[model samples]
Target: MSETPEKSAKASKSSQAAQPAATDKANSAAKPAKPAPKPKPEDKPFAAFINDDLLPALKQSLTERHQAPISLELVEGDRPVVGGNCWMVQGVLPSDRRFWLCFESDSITSGKTIALAETGSDPSLLESFLIDEKRINLALLQSRLLQRLNGQKWFGGN
Candidate 1:
């Protein structure tokens, strides 16, 4: 069947309009999708222990016992763990004396640390206590270390 010129023109015009809509859809699809936002991380056991428990007790004990400024820092990991978190502790007393402690945290309330080691300020103490590794309570460890550092500085005894 032969179509009239006007009818053929009208068909071409509609087809051209449809092409633009299709092109628009394709263009939109070609654009990159927006990236999803990162979720806020939940606290790990070790981090909670450091923040909620250790820092407070250390600060209070330092205040009451020493009457000197003491700096306690987690110089290492706070990664999530099943049993507990493990980290290295760096402590600085008012005399600017520095000590490093390594521990495997069992919980906020309990953990194990090397009370003395073969490498530190007191070489004699370290060598003597090297094989005497024991899991002392954190508070006891903290107090003992602070006292020991003071003793080394002044009284010069372990």
Candidate 2:
């Protein structure tokens, strides 16, 4: 039996509306979507090592030894390692009252500064030490400092 034109038009409109709802439901079921979260900024890892741990340790060590007022200054420049910059520590030893300890980037090993002595009274002592690559070995610096502190040796085996 054929439906009347008016009834047929109403049925077609209802079907069209149902189709849209069905499509919407299908789309929602097809994929479970998650809301994307915003990315956080990368935090500097060496902040604690430089500011909290290393600086305080060095200062205390110097003070206990009765060395001159040890002042650690961060040297600003482009270094190969991230957050790797030279540290200049000025203090006096028991033997040599006026001295400077240079913690150059090249002289750092195993997360420790290889303290090097600034021998001359040149105005640019820090600059001179950095420029001379051969003298900045961390092991050598450690040995030299030990010797100096013990009054065993005058020069570091560079």
Candidate 3:
């Protein structure tokens, strides 16, 4: 038995309305489950530079004529000012300049240390002797130390 046009139209509208609800149900069923949260990067084993060998080497290198052995601290985990896997070398110089060197690598990238004389003189000679590619070298540091030991005055010398 064929229905009247009005009844057929009403039936079609109801079926159309029901179709979206059925599709929604099917889509909800087909979706994959939610993924778990990822682990933090700091949870893994990170490189540390304050090992036995490195600490002594750094302390010896940073020590000055009158200054005591520099203290080394390993800054691990989250610290706003300090990054992970970083080392902080703090010491007081003979001239009273509180020096703080923040080594931000797993290994020693640069082994040189440069200091300006107290007089604030031209640092060109010092720079030329100390810096190579804007990095300090061992020879330059040794030379500077020797120069300091002698009575001769260099740039920024007292």
Candidate 4:
């Protein structure tokens, strides 16, 4: 039996729609979607940024410059200076010098402070960073840290 013109047109339309759906399924089976990329250090939460990117970069930088391993620790607690829970990156050199990079809060937007103490002494050098805290990045953190250490003649020259 021959189909009428209306039935033929309807069958054609349905076949055409089914063809695209089959093509889409085949294409999807052949190609998988890529996963999303990880966020950059500056884009991550403050603690994650510090632990993942900032500390590693700082340790590498300091170790390369000082010609020895540099130790770094992140301590979170109720700091007397901030009067609340704060984040501090404490670093130690082979020469027994210690430095603390303190954040006023667990946020990149918070202000920052620094203190450095020589061997067998209390923190003798304390100061607030002058840069905008919100603009911090790994490079900036490393630069500021080296600059402060250099200023104290820790690397032995001006």
Candidate 5:
């Protein structure tokens, strides 16, 4: 039983076709796919970020912790310590405890100053915080502020 040359040629052509497809599949599997680039976040002004994003976040955090929403407002006046104009967010707790969160400058790269005081009295807990300006966001601000307050035992701890 001798095989025909035509059948042999046909088998060879089919094998050749299958070989390339298999190689293509293997090559594709071997190479890693490039990842999609992450989208760049929109840069917002310091004042807008505070007023639109930070104030509400802080208020919500305080409300969740203290069971009453703290009043927060943006104020522009002389810095309490340096005597220069800056942005400040004043928060008044339900129990009459007051706190001031101040920025050293209008830029997001600036440092921060925070003070916690009783009503009608100077601040008893004053602290300065340095944050990564490039990565500043609502979550970071809220975390730092809450951490600072907790450190000072502001929410009823002695």
Candidate 6:
């Protein structure tokens, strides 16, 4: 015997509900995946400043003036300040010398306008440099360093 009217209506309702579920699964499977996001272009160049350009120039400057080698260790802050990476450097100047700290900033202006790469401590090395009648000028040294690295790649010198 043919199906009853009530049975046919029930079958029709069930098939209609099943259509949407099948359509949803097929739609999701057909879609392409989203691409991974790209990193900022500044990341590489800023890192170069820390490793290649700034650190070497700092070492050379210290060696020339102090007559011994210098080394820099990363002193990452709790959070980086805007406009650059966290390059707060703490190291030994002239090997086995006193601990020194350098706060990186473009705000510090010197002749020829190169990025500042120098260190300080709580009246330690800074105190010794002030001997000889408050002379042995730090600004002159800073200017000299900025001048030296003025044309090197990184620090936007190139």
lDDT of each: 0.52, 0.45, 0.43, 0.79, 0.75, 0.44
List pairs with backbone clashes in candidate 3.
117-156, 118-156
Candidate 3: misplaced stretches above 4 Å?
Answer: 1-50, 58-64, 76-86, 92-96, 110-158
Q: What ordering of candidates by TM-score runs from best to worst?
A: 4, 5, 1, 2, 6, 3
Task: Identify the superior model by TM-score, candidate 4 or candidate 6.
Answer: 4
Candidate whose lDDT is highest? 4
Return the clash pairs for model 4, or none.
none
- lDDT for each residue of candidate 1 in 1-158, tens digit (9 for 90 to 100): 89999999999999999999999999988999778875322223666656565666666766665534467776555422222345655555555555555455434333434323222343122111112435434465557655655555432343
> How big is the positional error of residue 139 in model 5, measured in Å on the Cα after superposition?
1.2
lDDT of 5 by residue, 1-158 (tens): 87799999999999999999999999989888778775322256777777777787788788788735457888888666456788888888776777778887776557888878765777754577655456766677779878877776766685
Candidate with more favorable, higher TM-score: 2 or 6: 2
Please give the distance, in angstroms, between residue 129's alpha carbon in candidate 1 and its true position after superposition: 8.1
List where candidate 1 sits over 4 angstroms from the true fold.
1-44, 77-86, 104-138, 150-158
* Clashing residue pairs, backbone N/CA/C < 3 A, model 2: none
Pitting candidate 3 against candidate 4, the one with the higher TM-score is 4
The order by descending lDDT is: 4, 5, 1, 2, 6, 3
Q: Which portions of model 6 show Cα errors greater than 4 Å?
A: 1-44, 78-86, 94-158
Q: Count clashing residue pairs per candidate.
A: 0, 0, 2, 0, 0, 0
lDDT of 5: 0.75
Q: TM-score of each candidate?
A: 0.40, 0.32, 0.28, 0.68, 0.64, 0.31
Q: Number of clashes in model 1?
A: 0
Superposition TM-score, candidate 2 onto the true structure: 0.32
